[model samples]
Target: MPPMADIIAPQAAAALLAELVRCPSVTPLAGPAGQGPYGEGRYAALLGDRLAALGASVEFREVEPGRPNLIARFDGPAGSPSVMFEAHSDTVAVDGMTVDPFAAEVRDGRLYGRGACDTKAAMAAMLLAVQSVLAADGGLRATVYVVSTCGEEITGLGAKALVGDGFFAGGRVDAAIVGEPTDLDIIHASKGSGRFHIETRGKAAHSSAPADGVNAIYQMAHIVAAIERDVAAALAAMADPVLGSPTVSVGTIRGGSQVNIVPDACTIDVDTRLIPGQTFQTMAALIHGVLDRSRAARGDLQYVIHNRPAYPAFFIDGDAPLPVLVARACREVLGRSTLRAAPWASNAGIFAEAGVPSVLVGPGSIAQAHTCDEFVEIDQVVQAAKLYAAIIRAYGGAGAPATGARGE
Candidate 1:
């Protein structure tokens, strides 16, 4: 390994972030004549080269047909515990951005571009942290894996593959640190999410004829109203202490072909958030119970509900060594302790389900994610690098916590 002074610097990390912003690795990867590079491969390769420069063995493994996740590992002593730092490489589409999405422009102490805050900033920080650790200590007591995963903005295909397939050869991970914008705070718990569609079918009839056909729109209105009154209220009362309450929102609705005809069918898409101790099955059953009562009352509605898979909510014990290590890193490096729960779902939840204790920590703010003119403060990115480096030194170097097991 190289010496600390010769390893990548904070400025190099920022420059690397600019290079990533220039790739335009949009989700639903599309690469053709006019389209941007596909599967985020361009940016993945760019990151891979940087990792390789720091003596990490890098591999690009396919998660989907064209989309791949980049896995890089820095070796340590034989049989040493291992830890992972993961960040997504993909960004949401830059459809309505107010600024040039790929320019990588810097102004007034900020870097402006898509994926700047949502994730790429954290990615840069983690990379530099690993570089710094390897440079200063030759190796670590724990082997470290720095994963730049793809498809986090959409399907989470990358994390799924890595966790399900044991993509890393370094046995089981002792801890996984997922990077997301928390304004440099530490997140040990988060809500899960589920999506489903509700449809009500009815007979179509001419609008000129009154009371000749069942009105699906009217029926759906009743269902929506019932959900708002019954389901939402019930969920609100059964809140999770850390994640607050589970909630549902009717996001999109469609009905009626034209105003001249009574609609034959109506459909609504719903997003439901889940807190810990709530399973998707239990939530679906509750929804069905409410809808059934509505059906029983009217005895005149025809409706169907279909639910997609749910992302399970997760909470790690706050007093655990991982959080302790992270908090110590923050206090020692940044002179502050910022710990909170994130409202949004990330791959961290999925990792928890796989029995890997995970936490979300990084730079910037979540508000900037997926927004037009999205940017990350330059100072935040630099501080994030320092924080991550401190964590690596504290947990992976000689000062590692003594109480945690491999999967704790």
Candidate 2:
């Protein structure tokens, strides 16, 4: 088979990424599915059709009512390893952007758009590599599932459904390569995120009679400080070596409804970055302890915590075959490779949680992800294609499947 460079023209590569960026796939809000450009259905349609044209069997399965995930399967020899290349179909909100979000413009060799750096570039690279190998007669080495998952930006719903539905045809895929902006490095470990709202309740009263009503907002200040000071210290003591310390931050706060009324309720949304060993249960206990400490100081405090869905932490030992092969593949393509950790999470973690041997890799710098001017270096996208092709080939040739590598 010819090299990917010979098969994929430079313009063709850029054009593919440009086409993906041109689609509007911002993660949708709580609205009717497929009603507008906000959901991933339209983008999934484009990818599904293209993958189908490339001789893959495509399936559009909805994670939500209209938000479908694009699953495309490419056949190989029957006994070969099955590998999944998962690139998210949704981007962060386009609330703040210096460039036109869906313009898909190229300037000074940078492909600029909303999802350009965060993941659309990775998706494009995966598509090109798959296409190149498929063009060669009987050159496809692995059974590949090129999946474009939806709802990865805010919720991991798409991944959850994929796993719950057993999308792998009753057999686990050998290795899953989750695509994110990794500067072409292999990310085997990443911090997960947990989000929840902490609310404090109090009796309402008029401003003139403030002493009669307990102030929930004022009490919540103590809880926030305690979490930052006490809970953070406790979390640091139990930090993972690779992913480092778990962290907590307060994002949005709301208290009194009006100026003159002593508000009966106040809530603060909290975000926590979790290490591998931490779970939602542990996070709740730690914060509950902090809240208890604050309650001991004042008797009138009333509090409740409302939990939200969490993205899991990802980790695998360095010696594992998945990471080893990925590193080798990158080195083969770019003359070097780096295995590292990430503070932010991705679909990789959810796969890891489901007992799939998973790792994160792809083009572009994370600094550009979700930025006002989100863009990916065109060269990096090309490198990503070659890297993925090499990795899939190597994984297929290996005698063993990727499993039993993650630690508790």
The candidate scoring highest on lDDT is 2
Deviation (Å) of 402 in candidate 1: 8.2
How displaced is residue 359 in candidate 1, in Å?
Answer: 1.0
Candidate 2 local lDDT, 1-408, one digit each (tens): 555566565577789999988888888874455655588988999999888988899999877877888889998788777889999998887886999999988999899999999899999989888887766545577789999988887668899888888875455587789999999989988888888798999889997899989888888888888888998899878868787788888999999988888888899999998889788778888888788878888777789988885788888887888888888888888999899988888888888877778889999999999999999999899889888878767766756455644743
**Backbone Cα, N, C clashes tallied per candidate:** 0, 0
Worst 10 residues of 2 by lDDT: 399-408
Clashing pairs in 1: none
Give candidate 2's TM-score. Answer: 0.94
State each model's CA lDDT, in order: 0.81, 0.84
lDDT of 1 by residue, 1-408 (tens): 655544445557668789878876787744431255445778888889988987889999987765788988888688766788999988888888998888889888789999888789998888877877766776676778899888887657678788778763344677888999999899888888888799999989999883898889999999999888999999989887788899999999999999989988999998899987777888899899999999999999789999875577867767778888989999987899877888888988877777776788998899898999999987788888888888777765665653332231
